[model samples]
Target chain A: MTALEKKFVSFSVAVAVLFGVPQTVSAMHIMEGYLPPAYCVAWGAVCLPFLAVGIITMRRLVRQQRKTMLLLAMAGAFVFVISSLKIPSVTGSCSHMTGTGLGAILFGVPVTTILGVIVLLFQALLLAHGGLTTLGANTCSMAIAGPLLTWGLYQIGKKLRVPRLPLIFLASMLGDLFTYCVTSLQLALAYPSAQGGVGASMTEFLLVFAPTQLPLAVIEGLLTMLVIMGLETYAKTELHELREGRRGLFHDAE
Target chain B: MTRNKKIVVVSLLIVVLLIAGPLLALKGASFGGSDDAGSVKVEEITGGEAEPWATPVLEQLIGGELPGEVESLFFCLQTALGVGVLAFGFGYLVARKKYGGDRSGTAGDKEKNS
Candidate 1:
């Protein structure tokens, strides 16, 4: 075929492909019923301890300082907003932000864990984005593991005296990346490669997720930094109180 | 806009660019969900035997899968609820700073002491 004709044909083919199929709105959350029953139960069992801790921490914060309830709601809202946005990525696949990092940074791991699970539960039931059966697995990756890493990174960065913005950015971004990594590992564990085993299967899932997730992580990090800056600007007193309360609580633990 | 407002606007623009840049650059690519991609891989690995074992409750109740529009509506509602709560929180903070004045500090201190 001549060059112009070939170009025309390829353009038509692309248009056809785009319009031909009915698009299913699958999302980043492992879809409902995706995992086997045993795997689902196991993942749920693993999350129970974290959920318990999150509940206790949240209850204590609300009871001790009533003002924190509003902040906690805001944190949950942040997760909801960030995760709901499925931004397009370089891989030509869409993914979402965890938004757990901001909560973890602001409120710490246990409260963020609760926020993440709540968001996941809402997404699963209301939007059918994630499944009820797979809620445990999703909670493990998105809520518990992601926020834990973000909180740990934030703590370490604070101790190291890193600048606030960069530290928040790194913690949020890396936390997001780590969540996807955990997700890949979860999927690989359930369905190991016959030829190459779990390692190979994990590598495959990681490759599939990485391109979409990397850019998303950066966006999430930037957005989180901005939100933190905004909070510092407008809610200085509340933020200060939260910090003091966190320190006091830690001291009590020690 | 003030300096902080300017920064927020620029950062938001950058975020917009980050999302839009990929779509403009990668013409004709279907920006499918990564989860869908992961599921496809699972299906491939399992030789097409890795079907989802349960239906979403909504789908089950409806006796069919949700149409794309219905799904989008649900997503929009979710976003609306979140944005509403966020707006309320920020507005409350700003109002407290502006009008509540000493009352804000006194209330906060009371909570702290208690």
Candidate 2:
């Protein structure tokens, strides 16, 4: 296939899985049995080198500023703590922050890859939000799509020349939405049910998760944007240095 | 000079975070575990059980045994690799284009990178 055709096919598969398929499969945490051993092993193996690469990149970023490293670590820790402290949402479910949107926006995708690995490790080890066997899938869902989509939305916003706040906000919002949507799609694809299985139709799954997730995405996006914008406005010096890489932005904001 | 600029930015980020680090922490302490611990609560939902393409695999895994079939393993591996590579490669390119430095350079001029 041509490049455009390839892109189109990929896009169609994503949409088909996310919106067109059905069932209430728990895609995000990726329940243990849902993945084949080989898939898990292969992904886990591939993640090994990427994890090294991520560490190298982070070390380079950190060597520039020890405090920036500490701050990012703290930010990651804070995310772990807050997300673990889940709040009640719908009757049968609870929700927590994914924290990927802002992480992607500020640090870029490479660093977010590291951040994702760390966050997932902590969440699994300490909080038990996700299990160890399924860590690969979880990392792929949040770390991969979260940052990728965040960067994509940011570019779209840049091309449109929207204001900085709106740009960041929209980017974050869409990033969060796509992260959850992708996770849902991943689950559906992993576990396709018969016509009358417990898994709801893809549209039904979308309807169920979308209401809560869409609003949560907006909330998270705004929160992240506001924090970033607040630093930009009131603490421009800190932000300038942080953005410049001399000082970390979260260091001052926190 | 450009490298110095980068260093300066990184340094500033460190100091700023050091000063502002505590605020990122979630406050207050939980004195006790949540009420739901060890409680088996049945949730009533409005959906029927759906069929699965890999129901046997799912059942086996849930039952604490890995699937013995090689086809299942290949299926999962193929999907995982495809998605993993897509996620990593595309994600890297997007980030590089947006924030790695300058964006004026063309992103996808050659097939090798893609």
Candidate 3:
């Protein structure tokens, strides 16, 4: 195939991947039925308002930049590709990139969030990767929590006048790390330690995951930055309009 | 080459370096994920015999593990569907913007007035 074809293919595939982790340590999506019904319900409930907001945000974005629709689609496809590719982490577990933050950064928190929930749901049903019950928790960490972090960081980056690429790298990295941290905490809450209880359990999960998650976060961050740069070149007009639309949003708020 | 073209080329090179750099550096290494670590961590904290609070609903429904190939096929199909929906959706939006003109920009216009 031609280089153009390859680039298009990668555009669909390579938004995020890497720093890597061991699958045995913690898989990408919490497997089906991994969380108790109560945890599932609680997490699912937590996701509702975010998703509602996301739906609203998505509509607004479509109106703001017609080309944003394409960006949104590409973002979703990117998430699917990255999450599906199981990478070998240094620690001997098969892990995958969350790709949540990049979506959030590109499309805004709400729409990227909805995309995450839908993608997770699809993974649960189609690939048997994650279960239906744990959808809420998975969505919460990967979609809601991670993207929120990205949006906040992105805003801060804008205010601080940080170079766009570096800011994106940092935001993407933090977003990926935050997801693992939340997932670990979720697991910790479910099963507290013998002596120190929940805190200890949380600590234990963090320690175990840190070995892989730390590097993976860095890899993901760089990957996200590179992808955005690519978009800057290929999708310049859409990005410019989108940036203008976002600026108008904040400007209006003031 | 144009600036955009140069950046795209450099970006591709960077991507190639990322993938290859790691493979070479981490040769003979073990790569894995936390799928089972969460469970093991729970077990260690609670002591052995820590039963899973949940089990795979799909597994119970299917009565056993689905073949790996079947699972992979589903994943591929899901990716294709996701790509198709997103591409088509975006294409429609672009076309609409091209023909319909820019009514959406009206909202941003208000910002200028204030």
Provide the TM-score for each candidate, comma-separated: 0.87, 0.55, 0.76
Ranked by lDDT, top first:
1, 3, 2
- Arrange candidates by DockQ, descending: 1, 3, 2
Q: Write the residue-wise lDDT of candidate 3 on A1-254 in tens digits.
A: 23553454344223211111111122136766666676776676666656655665566677656666777777887787667666555565656678777788876776777889878878777666777888878887898788888888998898999988779989988988888888888887777777887778888888777666766676677767766875664465567777776632111211
Highest-scoring model, TM-score = 1
Share of reference contacts kept by candidate 3: 0.44
Chain B TM-score, candidates in order: 0.81, 0.29, 0.56
Backbone clashes in model 1, listed as residue pairs: none
Give the winner by DockQ. Answer: 1
Decreasing TM-score order of the candidates: 1, 3, 2
- For candidate 1, the per-residue lDDT at B28 reads 95
Candidate 2 interface CA RMSD, Å: 14.3
Model 3: DockQ against the native? 0.27
**Higher-TM-score candidate among 1 and 2?**
1
User: Per-residue lDDT for B19-51 in model 3, tens only?
Assistant: 555556787765444766766776777677566
Per-candidate clashes, comma-separated:
0, 36, 32
- For every candidate, how close is chain A to the native chain A in TM-score? 0.86, 0.72, 0.83
Error of 2 at A68 (Å): 3.6
| Per-residue accuracy of model 1 over A1-254 as CA lDDT, tens digit each | 33553464455445433532222101137889898787676677666655655665676677666767887898899998989888899999898899998888877775776788888888887777888999978987998788878888888898999988889989999999999998998888888899999889989999999888998998999999898887887788778768777752111221
